[model samples]
Target: MFVIVGLGNPGKQYAGTRHNVGFDVIDYLSEKHNIPVNKVKFKGLIGEGFISNKKVLLVKPQTYMNLSGHSVLEIQNFYKLNPEQLIVIYDDIDVDLGKLRIRSKGSAGTHNGMRSIIYEIQSDQFPRVRIGIGKPQKGDLSNHVLSRFGKEDQEEMAITIGNAASAIETVVTEGVNAAMNKFNG
Candidate 1:
């Protein structure tokens, strides 16, 4: 089984924020694959279903962004899941808006969620899909991520999220390298 985790803060206040882009991508995947990610467990929401003949456990950490590792570790231990079987999706401020970057393993950069996951998992060797959210011109990043997207951002984010979700499907079926080539254009 594979644990597909989307990192983000939970609550209505954070619903449409850029930080929730991971959740957005997962929602797209759930809809496309007919999986209902409504089951709550391991301090997150999860849905179990088959995709590409692989039993996937879709997870959205409810412990918020900073403490994301708590839930990830819990799920990992309970399922006896390894880092290789975990695919984390989240927003990236470094990349330009609407662009996505996939990596097998790398530094957390400035992302707290990724940092926390790496700390608890004891390894950064895991697949991740980063949806670019873009940085703000000024002020705190936390405020920026929690803010709603502008009109232009909304338009681009739709296509970005949909494509990212498809790319995730590709990863499960066609492998990471192939999906990267197909999606990272």
Candidate 2:
């Protein structure tokens, strides 16, 4: 079994924001697979189905973005799964818009949600597919992340989120190395 977690704040206001890119990506994946996120479990809204012939649990942390680790740890503990079996999808501020980065393992950089997950889980050994939302040109980062994307960013965000979804699917079926080679480069 493999677990895929998408981090984001819960609420209508944060729906299409850059920080919710992870949620969007997982939504796309779930929609494509016809898996509805109907169950509230493990501190998250879970959609269960098979991705690439592997049992997959698509988790959208309802605990919101910053406290994402609470939901993740619950799922992690319940499944007795290792860190390597987890794939986290989240937004990145460094990479260019419309770009996707598939990493085997790395520090959270500036993402508070990921930082919290790392702090709670006590490891950064999990695979992650980062959907780039780009850096802010003005205003605070928190504002930028919480705010919706501009017209220019909308198209790019759509494309990047789709790519991120595919990259995660690749990880589910092919293992971290294959996903890294196919998506990272």
Candidate 3:
């Protein structure tokens, strides 16, 4: 079994913000697989189903971005899963918008959500799928992540979300290496 977590702030105000891309991917996957993520557990919404014949628990941490680890730790402990069974999806400012970078394990860097998960779980040896949100051209970093995409980028954002969903399916069916080879570009 694998726990696929998408890091994002909860609430309607943050629904379409750049920081919520992780949630977006979770939503996309839920719909694609016909799994309803309506269960309130582990301080997050979760949907259990089989993806590519592998048992997967789709998670959206509701503890907001910075405190995401609390929720993740709960799920991890409940499932008795190893660090490698965790697959996190979140936004990254270091990469260009609409791009993806998959890693078997790595540091969180500037993402507070990832940091929280790593700190709480006591491990970073987990697969992560980072969707690029692009650095802010100017102004505060918080503002950039909290902001919604412009009309020009909406199309690209949609495509990226879809790709992220597919990439996750690939990860479950094949392996992290297969997913990285196919989606990380």
What is the C-alpha lDDT profile of model 1 across 42-89, one tens digit per residue? 999999997889889888999989999999999989988878788999
Poorest lDDT segment (10 consecutive residues) of candidate 3: 166-175
**Model 2 scores what on Cα lDDT?**
0.87
Best by TM-score: 3
lDDT tens digits, residues 1-185, model 3?
98999999999999999999999999999998888999999999999998888999999999999999999999989989999899999999998999999999999999999999999999999999999999999999999999999999999999999999988988888889999999987
lDDT of 2 by residue, 1-185 (tens): 88999989898989998889888988998899988887999988999998867899999999988899999989888999899989999988887777888888999998889998998888999999988787888989898778888897788777777778888888888787887888775
Q: What is the C-alpha lDDT of each candidate?
A: 0.90, 0.87, 0.95
Best by lDDT: 3
TM-score for all predictions?
0.97, 0.96, 0.99
Where is the poorest 10-residue window by lDDT in model 2? 152-161
